[model samples]
Target: MNPAPKSWWGTPRTITETIDNRKISWLELFSDLIYVVIIHTFVENLTEHFNLFGFITFWVLFLFFFNTWTNMVLYFDLHGQNNLRNLFFALLQVVAIAITATFTGEAFAGHYTGFIWAYSFNQLIYMYLYWQTMRNDPLHATTTRPFLIAYVVGEALLIGSIWLPSLPLQQALIIISLLIFVSTVMSEHRNFDREFKQRQIPFELNSAILERYGLFTMIVLGESLAGIIEHMTAEHTHLADYTHFGLALLCIIGTWMIYYTLMDERKIEADRYWPISFFRGIHRFLIACLTLQSFFIGQTLGTGQLVYYRGLSLVTAASLLALLALTRLPRFNVQPLATWPTRWLVLGIIAILILQFAPVFVGLLLMDLILLGIGILNWTKNV
Candidate 1:
C-alpha cells in the first residue's frame, strides 16, 4: 500500500513494519522529563501526608498523571513521527503538563480551578491528536476511535466541571471522567482479543513499547533513590541512622535488580486482550507500591513510626510478589517462577512480614537481607 500523503501541516508515519523496530526518539525521552517533575512534586506531597488518607490521595493523583502519560505514549508509539507537527504538539503537551503539575499538589483543595483547566486543555490537545491520527492513518481507525471518544467525553466532563460550586463536586466530576476513560480503553482492548482471533488486526507487542515501560519504571524508582539520598544527607546522624541507611540502600538496589531480572526486554505476542490488560494492570500496581515504599522507607528512617516501618516491609513484600505474578503471564517472555527462587521469594515475603513486629532497625535489617538474598539469587540464575 502506498503511504499516506503529507498535508501542508503534517501526517503520521505509516506502519511499514509488522514489528515497530524504531528506536525511541530524543523527543520521546525529553517529553518524559516533564512527567518526572510531576512525579517529584507528588512525592513531596506524599511526604507531608504519610498516612492512609495521604496514600489514597497520592494513588488517585498518580493514576491521573499516569493515564495522561499512557495515552501520549500509545499515540506516539503507534503513530507518532519526528516531524515539525509532532514537535509542536509535544511542546504544547509539556507546557500543559507543567501547568497541571503546578496545581497538582493541591488539586483536590482550593486549587482545583487551575488543575481542571490545565487538564481539560491537555485532553483537548489529545482529542485533536487522536482525531488527526484516525484521519491520517485510516488503517487503524478501529483502534483510534475508542481513544478519541473517551477524550471527547472526558473533556466534556472536565469543562462542565468548572460550573460546579464545591471542590467535592469537582473532584467527583474528575474521578468519574477518569473512570469513563479507563472503561472505554479497557472495552476497546477487550475487542483486540476477538479481532486477533479473527485475524482482523495485527496486535503484537513491540520492543519500543517495552523499552518505554522500563524507562518509566526506572524514573519511578528514582523516588526511592532520592529518599536514600535524603537519609544520607541528614545532619546529626548516629550509628543507628547509619545502619538504617545501609539497609535502605540495599533494599532499593535489590528492588532494582529484581525488577530488571524479571522484566527484561523480551518481546511478547500481545495478541489476546487479557494478557496485555493484565500486564498493564500489574505494572501500574507494581510502580505505585514501589513509590509508596520510598516514602515509607524515608518515614521509617526519620520519624521511626511503626506504621511507616510496617508499610515499608509490606509494600516491599507485595512488590516482589507482584513480580512473581508478572512471571506467570503466558505471553510474556519470563517463565513462571523457578522453583528454587520461588521458594526464596515466598520465604522472603514471610520473613519480611514477620520481622515487622520486631524493632524498626532490626526488622529493616532482616528484611533488607532477605531482599538482597533474593536479588542475588535472581541475578546469578540469569547469569
Candidate 2:
C-alpha cells in the first residue's frame, strides 16, 4: 500500500506504520491546557449555584465538552500530523474553547448565545478536520464517517438553538445535538473491530491515544485538588475543617491510586466491539464523578448540610461504580493479581452504598480505607 499523500505540511501517519510507535505531541499537550480552563469554569459555576438544576446543567455541559475532546483526540490519534496545518487546527480549537469558557459561567443566566455560537464554531472546526481525514485516509473512512456527519448535524442544531425564545428550549436543543454526537461515537466504537477487520487491519492498543485519555483524566483530577486548596485557605479554622481536609485529600489520592493502577495494566480487546466503547464511556463517567466529588467535598466543608453530606456520599459511590465497571473490562491483564482488585472494589462499592446514609465523612473515610486496602492487597499478592 502507498503512503497517504504528503504536502509542505506533514503527511498523516498511517496506523499500519505508526500505531506501534506513536507518541503524544507537544501541541496536543498544550491544547489540553485550554481544557483545564474550560473545566474550571464549569466547576466554578456549579460551586456557585450548588443546586439540583446546577448539577444537571454541569453534567450536560461536561458531556458536550467531553464529546468534543473525544472527537479531537480521535482525529489527532488517527490522522493528525505535526505540521503547520495541524498547528493551525489546534490553535483554532484553543481559541474557540477559550471563547466558550468566557460564556460558560453565564450559560445558565440567559446569556448562553455566545456559548452556543462559540461551541458551534468548535464543531465546525471538527467537521472540517474529519472531512480532510476522510479524503486523505480512505482506509479509515468507516471510522471517520460517523464523526463527520455528527459534527455537521450537531453544529447545525446548535446554531439553530440560538434563535429559540425560551432558555429551556435552547438547552433542550443543545442536549439533542450532544446526544446525536455521543450516540454516533459510541455506535462507531461498538463497530470498531468489525470495521477495522474489514479493512484488513488488526486492532491493537494505541499507546499514544491511551496517553491522551490518561492526560485528560489527570487534568480533570486537578479539580479535586483545587477544591482542597480552596478549603485550606479559609479564614477561620477548626478541628472539623482539618478533618474534612484530610478526608478530601485522601479521597483524591485514593482515586488517583486506583485509576493509574488499572491503567498500568490496561489493554485493548479488539475482538469485542462493545468493550471498546464501554471503556471510553466508563472513563467519561469517571471523569464526571471526580469533578462532582470535588464540588461535594468543598460544599461539605463550607455548608455542612444533610444535602451536601449526602451529595458527597453519592458522588464518591458513583466514582466507585465507575471503577468497578472498569475492572469488568477484559482489557485489563487480571491474571497476575488473581482477581483481588475486582473483588475489593465491589466490596468498597457495597460499603459505600450502605454508608451513604451515614455522615459524608464516614463514607469518605471508608472509601479511603477501601482504596488503600486494594493497593496493599495488590502489593502483597504481587510479592
Candidate 3:
C-alpha cells in the first residue's frame, strides 16, 4: 500500500479524504462494552453507601475509571494502528478493566490491591501506546511529555501505596496517587494548544469524536432503562412502584430528548471558538451527570412504600439541575438548548430541593413534572 498522497502525517489519520468520511470503527465501539459492566458495578457499590462520604468516594472512584476510558478512546482516535497491535492493547485494557471491576465494589474498603494493580495496568497500557507513537513521532511525544511523566509516577505511587500497612500512611499515599493522576490529565489538556499551534496542519474535532460521546451517553441511558425494567418486572409491585417506575422511564426519556437535541456536531462546529478546555469540561461534566442520574434511577426504582428517602430526592434533583447547568456552559452556546430556560431550570431545581424533604409520592410526581416541562422545552423551538 502506498504511504498516501502528499501525507504530512500527524493530525490523526483517517480512513478517507471525503468531506463526510469520519466514521468510528467497529473495534472502537466493541471496546465500550466493558464500560457498561463497569458502570453497573460502580453503581451497585454507590447504593451500598448512600451517605455523604460514600457518595464522595463513589465519585472519586468513578472519575478514575472515567478518566482512564476517556483518554484511551482519545488515544485510539489519534493513533490507533487498526492491527494486531491495537487489538492486543485494547484487549489488555479490557482485562485490566474487568479485574478492576472485581474491586470497584470495595476499592477503598479492603480490595485496594486488585484495584491498584488493575488500574495501574490500564494506565500502563495507555503509556505504552503513547510511547509507541512518541517513538515514531518525536513531536507527538514532546507534546505529551508531561502527561507521560505524571502517568508513570502516578502508577508507581498507586502500586506502592498498596504495600504500606499503616492505615494513615497508606491513606496519604492514596491521596498522592489521585493527585498525580489528576495532574497529568490536566497537563495533557493544558499542553494541547501548544501542540496544535506548532503543527503545520491544525487539528479539528470531528463528528466521529463527538458522536463517540453521544454514543456513550446512550449506553448510560440504556443503563437507566435497565433500572426501570428491573423495577417494573419486580414481584407484586404496588401502585407506587408502577407509578415511580413509569415516571423514571419518562424522566430518562426527557433527559434523552434534551441531550440528543442539543448534542449536534454542526452546532458545536459553528461555535465562535473551540478550546480544549471547552471540550474537556463539557464532556467530563456530561459523563459525570449521566452517572449521577443513574444514581437517581436506582433510587426511583424503590418499589415498596417508604422506600424513597430524602437523600434520594436530594441527589436525584441535584443530578437534573447539574445536568441542566452543564448544558448551559458558555462553550456549548452553538446548540439551541444550551442556554434557554435558565429561569425555568432554576425553578425545576427548586422543586427538586422541595422534593428532598417531601414524601416519595410528592417527590416523584414533582420530579416528573419538571422533567416533562424540560422535555417540552427541548422538543419545541419556542422559549
Candidate 4:
C-alpha cells in the first residue's frame, strides 16, 4: 500500500527556495485586497465625523486591523505551503478579513461590542487554520502548540469582553493579544534556532522572509495614501476648488519621498541583523506615522482649521514631525550619521520645522521642497 501523499501545509525544509520560487503564493496579494477594503472603510468613517475622541477610537481599531492581518501573513510565510487545502484556508482568511473590515465604521463609533465579536471570530478561523497545518506535520506540533493554545484563550477572552461593554474588557483583551503575540514569536524563534543548530536552514531563507515583510510595509504605505485621497475628495463638494487638496497631495508625495529616499532598495537588502524582527518593529512606527498624517490631512480639508498642539497642527503637522523623529532612532540608523543619506534627514527635519510655522499653504510648499531636496541628495549619494 502507498502512504498518503504528504500534506502541503507544513513549513518547507528550504525557506530560500520557497520564497525565491514564490511559494509564498498569491496569499499575500489576496491579503492586500482585504487590507485595501479596510482602509477605505476607515477613511469613510473618519470623513463622516471629525472629533478627537472619534479619531482616537478609530486609531485603536486601525491598529487591531493591521495587527491581525500582519500576524496572519507572518505565520503563513513560516508555515504555509502551496496546495489545494492551503489555498482554500487562505481564501477563508481573506473572507474573514473582509467581514472584519465591514465593521470598522461601527467599531469606531464606540460600538465595539459587535466589532469585537466579529474580529474575535475572524481570529478563531485563522487559529483553526494554523492548527490544521500543524496537525499535518509532527515536527511542528511541539513548537506551534503554545501559540495555538494562547490564541484560543485570547480569542475566548476577547469575545467575552464584548458582553461587558464598560468593564475594561477591551483593554484586557488587548493585553491578552499582546501575550499571544509574544508567545507565537517565541515559539517561532525557538524553532528557527533549533533548525540552525541542526544545520537545517540557510541564511538566504531568513533574508527572503525579511524582504517579503518589507513588501508588506509598502502595502501599508500605499493604503495610507489611498485613505488620504478618499478622505480629501469625499469631504469637499468641489475638492479641486480647495487649496487643502493640493496640500494633501503634496504631503502624500512628501511622505513617499522621505521613506523611499532613506530606505532605498539596496540598503534594505544589505542589512544583516535579525532583518525580519527589525523590519517588523520599524514598520509599525512607519504605519503610525502614515495613519496620523492621514488624520491631520482629513481634518484640514474638512474644517480648514489648524489647531496647534505644542506649536504644531495637533494631528497633521505634529504627527509628521513625530514620524521623522521616530525614523531617526538607531534601529533605522539615522543617528551618528556617517552617510550623506542620513545627513539629509537631519537637514530635512530642520527645514520641515521652519515651514510648520508659516502659512498653511507655504508650509506645505516648503515641505514638498524639502522632500525633493532629500530625494536629490539620496540620489547623489548613490543610495
Candidate 1 worst ten-residue window by lDDT:
13-22
Better of 2 and 4 by TM-score: 2
Residues 1-383 of candidate 2 have per-residue lDDT tens digits of: 34355556775565444444668889889989988887777777987776777877888888888888887887787767657788888889988877877887777454678888788888889788777766766766777776677767877888898898998898898889888878886667745666677766655446777788788878877877887777689734678878878877887787787777766645554565555676778878988887787777777766767687677677777887787776565563232234567778777778766776776677678767876777666555545
Best by lDDT: 1
Ranked candidates, highest TM-score first: 1, 2, 3, 4
What C-alpha lDDT values do all the predictions have? 0.75, 0.74, 0.66, 0.58
State which candidate, 3 or 4, has the greater lDDT. Answer: 3
- lDDT at 277, model 2: 71
Predicted candidate 4 versus true structure: per-residue lDDT over 308-368, tens digit per residue: 2112233334434444443444543423234455566656666666666677656666776
In candidate 1, what are the lDDT values of residues 254-285, reduced to their tens digit? 88888887677555555466666667768778
Decreasing lDDT order of the candidates: 1, 2, 3, 4
Q: Which residues of candidate 3, in runs, are more than 4 Å off?
A: 1-20, 188-190, 200-204, 266-275, 303-309, 312-317, 320-326, 331-339
Task: Report the poorest 10 consecutive residues by lDDT, candidate 2.
Answer: 329-338
TM-scores of the candidates are 0.90, 0.90, 0.84, 0.76
RMSD of each: 2.7, 2.7, 4.2, 5.2
| Model 3 C-alpha RMSD to native | 4.2
TM-score of 1: 0.90
